[model samples]
Target chain A: MMLLKSESLPIVSEQDIVRARQVARQWAIDLNFKLIDQTKFVTAVSELARNTLIYGRGGFMLLEAVEKDLRKGLRAVFEDRGPGIPDIEEALKDGFSTGNSLGLGLPGAKRLSNEFEIISQPGEGTRVTIARWT
Target chain B: MERIPILRMGDFLLVTIQVDMHDRLAMTLQDDLTRQIVASNSRGVLIDISSLEMIDSFIGRMLSNISLMSNVLAAQTVVVGMQPAVAITLVELGMSMPGVRTALNVEKGMMLLRECLDSDDSEVEDDAS
Candidate 1:
């Protein structure tokens, strides 16, 4: 696996979430990803970015383009220093939102990506990474 | 500062969401639509989302909210022109968007709204008679 390109954008406000989605869409398109793939990736980014802003109490998103064995991929990592999830298992469950949302962010993002990962520590922060390969 | 515009079309209120709405913008649209439905005394609401590339859970919930609120205000809400990819993504996101009626396009949505509104009005007329 090799990183070809990378960029970081702040996720402190609602507008940042929209920017995150647009950046993800552009990255997917640049990788020649199909329309469906682009939409799915962008939607996943929207969910995770919102989570980073609302749950993570504002953070940043890292976008990376990677090449692995001639296969290209796009990866996004959301990092936040807000109060971390106390129960990762429960939080991942659909309809289990601590906030008033529909509680689909974590699980939905996982479904939309080819690869998904989460790391969180109470009172510390949380980080979520997702990738889709072509 | 940008807000989604709502247009009056006969007994219906039409909103074409042409922007990639941020969270606050989506919420503001919801609020604005709800108020407009009452002020216009609209019998139906048609929302065109064909320009939207994606509908995350937040936006999906907002759409559902708009549908429900419109119903409570004695209006029928029809969301139309959802991209196939967005539809697939919404379902995969675990949001079926229950309680929200959808149409294939603006034309179909308008027809459905008119059909439902007509039936509703006739039902009220029968009660009055």
Candidate 2:
């Protein structure tokens, strides 16, 4: 299994989203991921980064290339210590957002990835993990 | 978060959107553009995308939707001055922005919009006669 990783910088602002996507794109290219898979990775990364800035006060993201049973894939984890999500289920629903959001960030991220999971507790924090196979 | 209306040339209205075009703002822009096209019964509209740094799939879909909505309102929509990097990202994401004409600069975009508007006017005149 080939492994690669990156930690999100503290400059977690909306503008940083573009930089995060660039990193993800480079990682995908290095992994020799398929074009479609690369797109999914970039899109998922963008959404997560945006979430980190918008919802999660600030946080870090880790990305890794994984291989299991001869199948290649990628995994990403975004963790934040911001005001945690009070309701995970409602958050997953499209158009359900706490901020003045279109509510497409989480749901759209889920649609772009093959696997998605979220862990959050009120006043604690939120962590989101997503994976997609190439 | 300030939307600055930079110019209005003939049937085209050019504005600079200086905030993240996500969430409610994105929706608002789409709705407003659609309404403007319908109200004016414009032949064509041009939107300047120079100040926009990033556009996610949602925004891309909205742009396409706006274009289609304009058509339904009997108008054409064109997007101008998208950065190359943003374009590359959009392409990689498999976003097919439909019904929108893309141009390299505002001048070129305005030229196209004018031509579309002129042709539309001629057609309307022909029908009237």
Candidate 3:
């Protein structure tokens, strides 16, 4: 997808996740996506945003409006400088939790987007990128 | 702190989550519902998420907590008004939200709560035997 515009929000607090969902929903609507699609984006942002705040030990999210093959969509990249995941595959398991949660982290967000990717280092941090096309 | 309003409807407490629920708000709802259920001695709770566009893992767990808590308090909880899209997203997200009773709308949700209350009564009858 070709980038239209991008903005970043800090994910250090729970309030940030709320703001991320709001911004993602507005972006999805601006792209003329349907309600369900917008909801999907908002929900995915909530999940990843939480991961960034809790697991990442504080990070930021980059929101991008993009166009792909003449279709508009939204992309979000969450980056955090915390203890990175030791095992990406196990983290994606449906009921897996490294902490106290449902553990529907990476997998759930991946399902909501048209494109999803994650990059992480053992002690550095983690970055997850996801995009949805209408 | 913005509180999501909870309305009392006879033996049922009605909570319409009309905000973009964050973690704190979801937790607050869980606490408030627990207190109201006990204080009012209500038999059922109907949580309306029609206006809610999203339910993350934290909020999803809060919903389940409310159900389990109300059950222990001798009250049944019914979640309703989940948008078609939200349901699809939850399923795709792999939450499935086991043990959380749901219905299409508020009216139907009340009906489900009543059914549970009826079953509770039947159980009491069996205990009397």
Off by over 4 Å in 3: none
lDDT of 2 at B27: 72
TM-score between candidate 2 and the true structure: 0.63
* Model 3 Cα lDDT, one tens digit per residue, B1-129: 789888998999999888887788788889988999999999999999998888877888899899999989989889999888888888888888788999999999998888888888999999999
- Over A1-134, each residue of candidate 2 has an lDDT whose tens digit, in order, gives 66545454442665566667777777777778776667667877887877887789878787777776686777888888999998889988876778865676787788778889999998988999998887
Q: Can you rank all candidates by lDDT, best first?
A: 1, 3, 2
Each candidate's DockQ = 0.92, 0.17, 0.83
Give the Å shift of residue B108 in candidate 1: 0.8
Model 2 CA deviation exceeding 4 Å by range: A1-8, B1-58, B61-76, B79-129
Candidate 1 vs candidate 3: the lDDT winner is 1
Q: Each candidate's interface RMSD, rounded to one decimal?
A: 0.5, 5.8, 1.0
Per-candidate TM-scores read: 0.98, 0.63, 0.95
User: Of 1 and 3, which scores higher on DockQ?
Assistant: 1
Worst 10 residues of 1 chain B by lDDT: B113-122
- Residue-wise C-alpha lDDT for candidate 1, range B1-129, written one tens digit per residue: 689889999999999999899989999999999999889888899999999999999999999999999999999999999999999989988999889999999999999988997798899999999
